[model samples]
Target: MSALLDEIFDVAGSVVLVTGAGSGIGRTIAETLAACGATVIGADRDEDRLGEIKDTQGVEPVHLDVADAGAVDNVVNSIVENHGRLDVVFANAGIARGGGLTTPQGTIDAFDLTAWHELLDVNVHGVVHTVRAAARPMKRQASGSIVVTASTAGLRADPLVSYSYVVAKAGVVNLVRQAALDLARWQVRVNAIAPGPFKTNIGGGGPIDPAVEARWGSTVALGRMGETRELRGLALLLASNASSFMTGCVYPVDGGALLQSLSLDPAE
Candidate 1:
């Protein structure tokens, strides 16, 4: 039974890359992969967060800004050159700014263009860069997995997040599908993990206000926000052979958040 389980979930010795490894879901994914015996290259623009995991047994930290296309290519090339192959990639770097339609700033008429562009540069373009760069080597190898970090917001509208955040995530959801179709011919799988409101630093890195947490939690059937650790099992499954037949799928780890309907009014 153990041997069979190992065979189904084996990821040991695989060369993996995870962007946005500094904190939140990305950090959890990177650490989980490394702990499972994959040679993980944890990349992030923040040197401090990278430093936090530098000494982790199977993780190698590197500076990376996924928004920069050239930098992304260079990093992927360097990884391939050093590791000889990239078996898995988590194109998970993203940022959130401004407010959703609930707030005055979030309304369409008052939305900040500068904030929108800045978020899109990192959230949308960054994912594109990572996927494009990773696809090259994966196609050459003819066997690799690309997991994108999408959001429940992408799957549907939500008033809790900013306009840019929703737009970027929604765009990537389709990107994952299109990329999956294009890369399937090469046996390189592409998928997206659309998470609900997990407690993470995506909203400017600090403790979440209890009232705000409760508000977000109310939208979930489980009635609570998810911890980063809760994502490990699915992350591992998608990265490993356990999900061999799964491709172009968008798996949501939302604790039934999608089952509930959200109100446009923040007070509701």
Candidate 2:
């Protein structure tokens, strides 16, 4: 049983790159992969956060801004040059700014263009940069796994998140599909992990108010927000050979958040 499990889920020695490794879901994924024996390149723009995990075994911390196409390309290319191959990439760097419909600032008429552009640059364009960069080496090797961090908001309309976030995630969901099809011939796979409300620093990185936490938790069927650690099993599955037959798929680790309807009643 142990050997069979290892054979199916083995990720040892796989060279991996995870963006946004400074905090939240990205950090969890990076740590999990590294612990599983994968040589992980954990990249983030926040040097401070990167410092937190710099000493983690099997993880190499690097400063990276996914929004910069050239920088992203450089990082990916350098990884391939140094490691000989990039077996997996987690394009998980993203930010949530501005307001959603629930807030007065989030209303369509009051939408903040500056925030929209800023968020999209990192959320949408950043994914594009990472995917494009990772695709090159993966195509050459003809075998690789690219897992993107999309949001459950992208899969449906949620008033709790910002307009920019929804648009960015929705856009990436299709982007994953298109990229998956394009990369299929080379035996490379692309997929998205549509996370629901997980306790992460994406929303300002501060401690959550108990009431607010409860509110977010109420949106999911499980009546709780997920911990970053909860994402590990699925993250590993997608990054490893366990999901060899999966591609262009969007799997939600939202604790059944999509199972219920979100009431728009502000008073509730």
Candidate 3:
């Protein structure tokens, strides 16, 4: 069992790249991969956030804006050029704007188009750029793993999240499936990780009050919000050889949040 686990989960020496590595789940994933002996290049738009992890043992920080296709391409191409191969790419940069439909801003008729476009640029277009950029080298190598951070909101309606967020995540869910089919011949794998609410800096980076925490927690069968570290295991599983035969699948790392209807705030 030990040998099997080691053989399947071994990620040592792999060249992994994670976007949105400045904070939140991306930061956790990057750090964990680096600790596991993979050479991790963490890219994010925030140089300050990148600086926080620049000196970590195996994490190399790069300033990048995933929304910019050219920028994403440049960084990805540079990595493959320098390393000779790109093993894993995580398209995890995203943003959340506007509250649920309970809020006037979140309702369809009252929705802010400006906010919608802005969120889409990062959440949706960002993933497209990252995946397209990563697909090139992965296809060339004929073996690689691409993981996108989707959300449980993508799979089902959640009145707590913004409309733009839900739409973007759902887009990537299918994007993963389509890309998986397109890249399968080359043996490159594509998949999405649909995470439930975890303590992260997505909407605004800060700690949630107990009351708010409890509200989100109640929706989860686990009766609590998830810690960032909890996602590391699944992130590693999808990135490593342990899931060699898996592709085009959306793995929910939500603490059973999808097991039942979401506990939403009252519609205003």
Candidate 4:
């Protein structure tokens, strides 16, 4: 049984790259893969965060901004050039800069266009850039796995998240399917992880308010937000041979949040 498990979950020696790896789900994914014996490359725009993980064994930290198409291309190319292979990529870098309609700044009538465009640039264009650049070598090798970080907001209307967050994620969800189809011909797999709320730095690094947490918890069937560690198992599965036959699927690791509505009203 142990051997069977190893065969399925083993990712030893594989070269994997994770963007947005400075913190949150991306960091967990990078750390988990490194611990499992894969050569992990963690990329993030924050130099300080990169510095934190640079010394971690099996992890090669790279300073990068995914929104910059040129930088993303260079990073992807450099990886293949230096290592000769990139078996997996987690295009996970993203930002949530705006708020829902409940707040004055988040209201549609007064929506911040600058914030919207900035978020889209990173969340949408960044994913596109990463996937496009990674596909080059993956196609040449005739094998690779690209995992995207989408959100539950993208799957449905939610008043809790910002407009940019929802719009960007929704774009990537379909982009995953489209890319999966195109890459399938080269034996490359593309998939999306549509996560619900987890304890992460996306909302700025700190503990969430008790009241907000309570409200968010109520929307999830599990009655709470997920921890970053809960994502490791699924991420490993998607990254390893266990999911060799899987592609183009958006797996939700949301503690069953997708099953409930994002309504704050008790009457609803």
How well does candidate 3 score on lDDT at residue 213? 84
TM-scores, all candidates, are 0.99, 0.98, 0.97, 0.97
Over 127-185, each residue of candidate 4 has an lDDT whose tens digit, in order, gives 99999999999999999999999989889988888888889999999999999999999
**Of 1 and 2, the candidate ranking higher by lDDT:** 1
Model 1 lDDT tens row, 29-144: 99999988999999999998999989988999999999999999999999999999999999999999999877889988899999999999999999999999999999999999
Q: What clash pairs does model 1 have?
A: none
Encode model 2's per-residue lDDT on 107-172: one tens digit a residue. Answer: 878989999999999999999999999999999999999999998999999989888999999999
Each prediction's Cα lDDT score? 0.94, 0.93, 0.91, 0.92
The CA-based lDDT of model 2 is what?
0.93
RMSD of 4: 1.4
Which candidate, 2 or 4, has the higher TM-score? 2
